[model samples]
Target: MAEFRQAGGKIDITATKAIAYHEVVVIGNIIAVASHSAKIGEKTSAYTEGVYEIKKGNEEITQGAKVYLTTDGAITATAEGNTYAGIAWRNATANDVVADVKINA
Candidate 1:
């Protein structure tokens, strides 16, 4: 038998640490962004899909480049030892601090 669950775009998460709104969160290999600010141990919603502005590393990311999440929660073009985040929605130069990333597309 099969059952239906809620839509998969958003999920409820318990904050392991204080999380600011829009901050990137990594659960296992899944990467998401907090929907709102939440204190440690508080429950919050996170969007698993859609494009968001995420901080980037010092590397230039071309449009549609595969981006990964660093240990410190920034986006990078390097895939080694990092979690897959999303694709860059636009080109990001080395001096750019952030990039639009479309996740779970």
Candidate 2:
């Protein structure tokens, strides 16, 4: 494959803790999904705007259901009048994973 101009790229940051792939991470007010695994003090990639399998909270999420960002960096459906993270790209059970998510929250 040939490399072209940058369409989207991940920002480099020092991981304070272990970050898994496809997990939602927030830097300041910016929300992005982890593109690669990174341990504490390691450099890794994270990007926004692409579909990703993000960690879900205790609430069950249905297809097309809207989700929100929890305090722990997981996506949830119980914002309770707060801002949402994005919409569910696939049906997900509680404590399971939600696939096909795009950042809208």
* Runs with alpha carbons beyond 4 Å of true place in candidate 1: none
**For each candidate, how many residue pairs have backbone atoms clashing (under 3 Å)?**
0, 0
Quantify all predictions' global Cα lDDT against the true fold.
Answer: 0.91, 0.72
Measured over all alpha carbons after superposition, the RMSD of each candidate to the real structure, in angstroms, is 1.2, 5.2
Task: List model 2 lDDT by residue over 1-102, tens digit each.
Answer: 997766665666778889987667877655777878899999887886756776666667888977777787677778774356777888877757544567
**Residue 53, candidate 1: alpha-carbon lDDT:** 89
Q: Model 2 lDDT vs. the true structure? A: 0.72
Q: Which ten residues in a row have the lowest lDDT in candidate 1?
A: 96-105
